[model samples]
Target: MRRTPHCRRAHQEHLGKGTPLSVIICDIDHFKQVNDRHGHLSGDRVIQEVAGLIARQLRAGDPAIRWGGEEFLVVVQASSGVAMGLAERLRSAVEHFHDPEVGQVTLSLGVAEILSGESIEQLLGRADGALYRAKRSGRNCTISAAGN
Candidate 1:
């Protein structure tokens, strides 16, 4: 699937006025295992259910996109601290989410705020890197970009 231009547009929309722009990269933890243990249909249901949970958690008008097969990207107008807080809340929401077929599902999230003059791709890269760290440290957790 093609990636959306939400971040770039948000960057352009907020650049000159000093708006705080943040991004969160969220991935379902051990999703492949879920597919293997359950089934593809079950996996799809898990995705849908998790997406609903995430959508309900976000503030109205926040953009949450399916960045990959089992990953989501959320764009927010908030500081790094606020983004981290949002990430934690999203994590907790996913942790507690239960599906009749899938039981419980968890998420690993990474958050990064835009740096001065940084491209949207760079900000997303940082968030993705933080997500990798969260996955490595252990799933079902949130990580902020290092030294942000």
Candidate 2:
């Protein structure tokens, strides 16, 4: 599904309007393995539960979107540090989240701050690179792409 207009507007307001924008790209760790081990139904339940948890934790100004299968994007009106904190919190939440059918879920997150004159593509690229770093270093952690 496409991202809602509200989600798009929030991104514009925060990233295009000169307001500080922090974008995070999160992916479930070993999600494919989960699907293989369990089943598609159980895997879907895990995705839904994690998405719900993220939506509940977000502020009114923040927006979270399911970017694609097993991946989510979070936009927050805050600085880089705040974004890192939020990502960490999300990781913690997923780690501790209990699912009777799927058990615990974990995620790796990549955070980036919108730079001056930067396009959405650039921001997303940075975040995606950071996500790769996080996954390579170890799963279930947050990585920042700023100043690198």
The residue pairs found clashing in candidate 1 are: none
Write down the TM-score for model 1.
0.95
Tens digit per residue, CA lDDT, model 2, 1-148: 2445654575688655767877889999999988999999999989999999888878866878889899999987788899999999998988999899778889999999877777667778889999999999989899999553
Runs in model 2 with CA error above 4 Å?
A: 1-17
Error of 2 at 133 (Å): 0.4
lDDT of 1 by residue, 1-148 (tens): 2446777677877786788899999999999999999999999989999899999989876779988899999999889999999889899998887898778899999999988878887888899999999999988999999759
By how many angstroms RMSD does model 1 differ from the true structure?
Answer: 1.5
CA lDDT of every candidate = 0.88, 0.85
**Candidate 2 overall Cα lDDT vs. reference?**
0.85
- Candidate 1's C-alpha runs over 4 A off are 1-3
Q: What is the TM-score of each candidate against the true structure?
A: 0.95, 0.90
